[model samples]
Target: MTPPAGYTKAKPGEVFRLKRSLYGLKQASRQWNKELYALLHSLKFKQSTQDYSLYTRTQDGEFLVVLVYVDDILVTGTSTSQIAAVKLALDEAFTIKDLGDLTYFLGIEVHRNDKGIFLSQRKYIKDILVDAGMEECFVAPAPLSTGLKLSPEVGDLLDSTPDVYRRLVGRLLYLGITRPDLSYSVQHLSQFMHSPRVPHLKAALHVLKYLKGTLDTGLWYSATSDLKVTAYSDADWSSCQFTNRSLSSYAVFIGSNLVSWKTKKQQSVSKSSAEAKYRSMSATTSELVWIQGLLADLQIPVSLPITLYCDNTSAEHLPENPMFHEKTKHLKRDMHYILEQVAAGFIQTAHVSTANQLADILTKSLNSSHHHVLFAKLGLISKVQLEGGI
Candidate 1:
């Protein structure tokens, strides 16, 4: 075929090649990123080393941030004109669509108010519940059953289809974006993805039943809160039935708003409760450092010594003391990275009572009272209003 005007020709008997950019071609993303980087450099925007997707430019003592995810861009600055100028510059170079005031993007529902921006996946949750045939099912009070120790011998499997089990788990994983309460239970059932027994599938459906009752639950960001970073860490010793491995969990907050959290089974067995708590604390500290870098790129300066609260006083004391007991020596070298940060004045460890530890919900199943307390602490609420604007 003959090549069109202003088009580049390929080898003999080949058609004209499509223009290389971020969205269309195989190597388009790399090429478009290179172009965007060059443009930002020309505009005096400095790229962050910690996260390359973040870019910043300062003028007249005011800061402007531009976060790029491929071709999608988010700009926030001290002034609207500054953001407008950057958008105009980008539009001149490439065909751009301005998504004014991000409401929905990348499966996350963004709600902004005078208080702050809140991000959730409520619509996604509703869709998953409807798809799983649980839209009309009775709503359970919790994501997991009380005293339910799901093991290899729970019951005879009813769902013989392995693909159905995988599909259910895949959808549940997406729900984890807003439902951190489901993290441990989801992680527990996900292990049996390959050749999932009938019991495993039943346990997963129980989680779906719980979601049916709490589909509207989500995290809320408060605009009135300060940007102080604090974290809580906890562990459930020997929680896994198959391996007897302990479960470690952590939840981080910027003031009263929860920002990040995790619930995962530890790979190695801990000798004591103190060892388990220490391991969980170490994992939480690593996440804290990464978040600090992210805030720095956004020009949000954090004061020295981020605070981390742990319920285990023994583990807290061990970090400051050089006397490593025989039992504590088994921890890997990488786990000590957090200790180094603490010594360098990057993080400060504190003590919290076990009852007040928000990460407890992530580590183990709790009773209704404790569950409600932790859920409220995590910024979740049940706001039921009458139809007549009651």
Candidate 2:
């Protein structure tokens, strides 16, 4: 609230009095966040520790949840009467406008039916295509070219501004929120944000071509989905040619519906493939602990000893092996954290064949047939495509 120059009228020795300016104040956004939190808290909503923007209330067999994202508010409850009452109360307090059930939020589109809910960013992808001048480009079968290896100094620099490359990659990162299929490709492209090369831009365009034909494809949340959690962890050892770092990725499921996924290069190089796979398993176990905590907040009971599948047999037995210190002396100490969870009966490890591993799609590119099979299993069903027999 510092006053602008030339508005003060006083001697240097005396206090200079000036009008306080509220324009562009630092507390604007912070004050707004506090105001929203206080208003929701006054309505008996308990804020979530895992995610501060979420608030929940349960009383007399009625359950309600409110999620605030800046100025936008999403309110829902199990009881229709209770939801209506809350909407009315919020509208009266804030003089707000109610946008019915969430058909669209941010840039993603939502459609629901008897089977489940589907989320897609078809419009967003189309907009990106137009911006990149690829509206009539050729279609492809997958996001990245098969066996394509990208490196920091592999190709010539783009004649276009580096800012342009950074912006496109940034948008693709957000697009991966619902498109788990794009997780690996986007993460791979993100590595060269500082100095993008021709190979990287070409790889990004390949992803756009794949999206061209599959615009209707989206994540499906089955209405019958339960709280049962299952996860698959996988890795590609030394995939990064530049740094010799392995790629680690895992996918989490709520019953049969895929809910969470991630793909990242391992922080350190592993001496053996088993060690790399073990690191991936540790990451998956850590995510499960957090997921279970969130489920607890929702009053849903999670059935454990939760099953974790890994394609590598050694990594599968690493947690239960009593002599891990002798066999894996070279591996990082953090890799043994899962052993404690296994001993506590909170986790169970199982062996899964490479062909059946869902996390495979998140770690590396696959053939057209293989990609389609995993895509269908991940619940990326397209209602429009199914109806039209595409």
Highest-TM-score candidate: 2
How accurate locally, in lDDT, is each candidate?
0.81, 0.85
TM per candidate comes to 0.87, 0.92
Error of 2 at 353 (Å): 0.5
Residue-level lDDT tens digits of model 2 in 135-174 = 9999999998777778888799986777878888998999
Residue lDDT tens for model 1, 45-83: 999988899899998787999988887888889988888
Colliding pairs, model 2: none
* Whole-model lDDT, model 2: 0.85
lDDT of model 2 at position 145:
76
Clashing pairs in 1: 22-28, 115-223, 157-198
**Model 1 misses residue 277 by how many Å?**
1.2
